[model samples]
Target: MTPPHPLAPAAPPVVPHVEVPTPRVPPPSSLSLPTPRRRGRGDDALPRPQSVVPGALAALAVSGACLALTLTAPAAPALLVAIVLGVVARAAHAVPASFERGLAWVGRRVLRTGVVLLGLQLSARDVLALGPPELGVLVVTVATTFSATLWLGRRLRVGRSLTLLVATGFSICGAAAVAAMSPVADAEDDDVATAVALVTLYGSVAILVVPVVARAARLSDRTAGLWAGMSVHEVAQVVAAAGAVSAAALSVAVVAKLARVVLLAPLVTAVGVVRRRGGARSGGAAVPVVPLFVIGFLVAVAVRTVGGVPDVAVPVVHGATTLALGAAMVGLGTQVHVARLARSGGRAVLLGAVATTVAMTVSLGGLLAVGALG
Candidate 1:
């Protein structure tokens, strides 16, 4: 009995209740911390030092190549080199976005400078020399070509952007015309690029080939100039083509080309107004201001004519323009891809040929009908 009592007592003493505490977790808000920020789409992350030097060197190399090509082939179309280079650059796909951004910046700057420099080469008297009859012919030619390009672009099922670019270049002063209209149309970089390429290629060919054709057709110097100015897609091309004929032809071509340039402001304004009025998909909103460069161009021309910029300054400006343009061409070439051009081979070539033929025919006909070319 004593032993049982001792064991029972021992069991009862171990029977005390023990309480276990539950662990608590912090609240969701308390546990949560600020997430590390990610770089945004527009962020300009610093490039590695190693990458920077090579990229700069590449850009310089490309620019040097363009300069060499241009110097070697002064009479040949410089625009062609630009186009080829652009195609190659685009195909490479290894080029940095920063390089492209730089190229675009240079292109715009050079374009503005080129426009201003062009004014030094002009005189108010030159514009007035166009006269009423010649003015009428120019107006008619521009209007007709513009309309025809639009209609044909639609008929051919070309993209809206391409159509606008082509029409502006064809109807106005070629590359300058397209460049001016790009912002109004809200054209993409590729659109601007493609248009430049086509215009450059065709314009170059026209400058070299058209003079021969004009001669074969028994067209006079004035006629050749008019045809080249009206049909060619760039001022430089017009000058080149005209120069191939005679000095008088060069004067006529430049004058005709300027007459086309004068139409740029009105055309851009009209397009802006039409876009605002819901003409053709509204094209987003109107830009706050038209391109300032266009105004600068006109102003420079006026100043040159009125202020009488020194004759020596004219050559210097022209040389600067050439260098800047060469730089832009190099930039453009670096963005081009030979592969894309090859893929677009037959179709693009065919389209370009057709467009050129159409432009030539219309320009020649208009010139002949108006007796502007003899």
Candidate 2:
């Protein structure tokens, strides 16, 4: 050690040079922090269009087959055939979860659209031509059949939804009426399937039964047609039954059936209003008191009445409506379980038979009362 001068700037003690590492901050672009995804109202986690294709295609295929069958056979009810195919497919477990979104879309949106188009088939002149006497008879017949079926269904201890569906179907336009009433009633698919099945079964039977009875009663062709139109559950069945008599009968019968179809819009609106009121009281999701499609249906009817859609386009409109409805039926049918239906279907069968009898009896009696059978 050397002695240091007292006041001299003593050499600074040797200090080691230490390097301080600079804090390394990465650029924002290179930072891998996850930003939260903000979902829009439309992002409700629905299936992609590609994912929905398979089910939609299947339903459309089935509808096409049904339409072909009806066109070729002239006796097959396309909607009935579609639902049967759906039921068979369901029983075989052919429907997968992936099919759900598309099937649901078909069942709801497509069905409603079809129903709106259905109104295009009728004109005010066609409905009005039935005359007050005939129209009065029509009203009475529907009311009696509907009320009796409802009472009978209650006695049979049928579920309310099934009962309502059956009552509507049997009293009005068969499967079409069932479809219309389902949403208003908030019915299960099983109920709708059962109701439709019953309508098909009994309406088919009517095709055989009505012609035989008409002959036995020595009824005129026009009278037979009127009877078939007034009482039968479906348009196809009415056609088959009336056509067995004469071409003139067929014309009368179809017009009569169209008149019945006209009542559907009002009935749905009334039921929807009632259901909406009930839902409000129960704190349930509010049902549309008058569903927009129903308004569309009325508009379609008015359009047809005013000849807004030309007669040339009638076939096209009708074909499109049938296809849409057939597709919807296929979707609804897929939801039905045969095992479950079999277990509960017996009471429905009995109700259907009784309803058929009531419809026939009331309509015939009304015709006689009004002397319209001539």
Candidate 3:
């Protein structure tokens, strides 16, 4: 122990009384950078249109199959086949994790765009060409079936969402109708898929059954066309059913079906109003009375009506529309797990059957009342 030199004054006693202030770090809230959005909600950081490429490719394959069938077999319902193929593929293996977001985008955004373009398939002239009696029959058939199916759905103890979706598909234009109403009705994705599946199944049956019945009932070709237009589910299915009867029947059926498609605008608006009122009562957000895509639909229809799109372009535009919708169907169908749907879907199938029956009955009644049935 070396002693310190005496001249080096003894070190001053350490000051015990002084308290040092801890340097303060500002809380995380005080940081200057803008806070980033949480990831799961799919904010700005998420992929956009490009994200849809993989799923779009998947859908493209379905579209190719659709074209192949259209060119070859000619009688096959290509979109329906696309849906089945997509469902089978997905049932074998879930879509890859990396492709989920893209598939979702196609199911919603791309589907919406396809639906908007569906408007181009119609012209106001073609719609109005169906005289008042024809229009009356259409409106009555759709309105009655839509309301009746909804009422019956509740009696069957089905979920309101499923009931609404099924009714829309059966009454209006099949899968397109289901897609249109799903957003306004706040239906679940699975609910929409179920509705589309039912429509595809029943509509396909109608293509086969309708022609046979027309002959058995001895329905005049014109009356049979009206019946096919009113009772069948999809435009294509109606065409097939009527075409099987005769070329004249095909002409009438397509016109009649287009009239129904035109009526979609008014029907959807009514549904939106009803849904918004219900949502208000339930303290939910009010769904818009017309979705933006629907407005685009109207715009497309009007453009077609005004001859904005050249006649020669119709086929090309129609092809694109089909492709877009086919892709959407593939995406929607892929979400469906047939085994699971079957396990949980007893009521759903029953509702679909009941709805189809109701629609067909109402349509036939309308045509009979109008003397369209000779």
Q: What are the Cα lDDT values of the candidates? A: 0.66, 0.84, 0.79
| Residue pairs with backbone overlap in model 3 | none
lDDT by residue for model 1 (232-314), tens: 87777888889999898888888777777777767877776676566443234445245666677668777877866877787
Candidate 3, which segments miss by more than 4 Å at Cα? 1-46, 280-285, 372-374
Tens digits of lDDT, candidate 3, 283-360: 245777888788988999999899988889978887787787777777777777777677648888888887778777
Clashing pairs in 2: none
Q: After superposition, how far is residue 285 of candidate 1 from its true place, in Å?
A: 4.9
Using lDDT as the measure, name the better of candidate 2 and candidate 3: 2
TM-scores, each model vs. reference? 0.73, 0.84, 0.86
Cα displacement (Å) at residue 73, model 2: 1.2
Cα lDDT tens digits for candidate 2, 11-92? 8899999999999999866778966444322212345677667788878888988998999997788988999888888899
What is the lDDT for 45 in model 2?
35
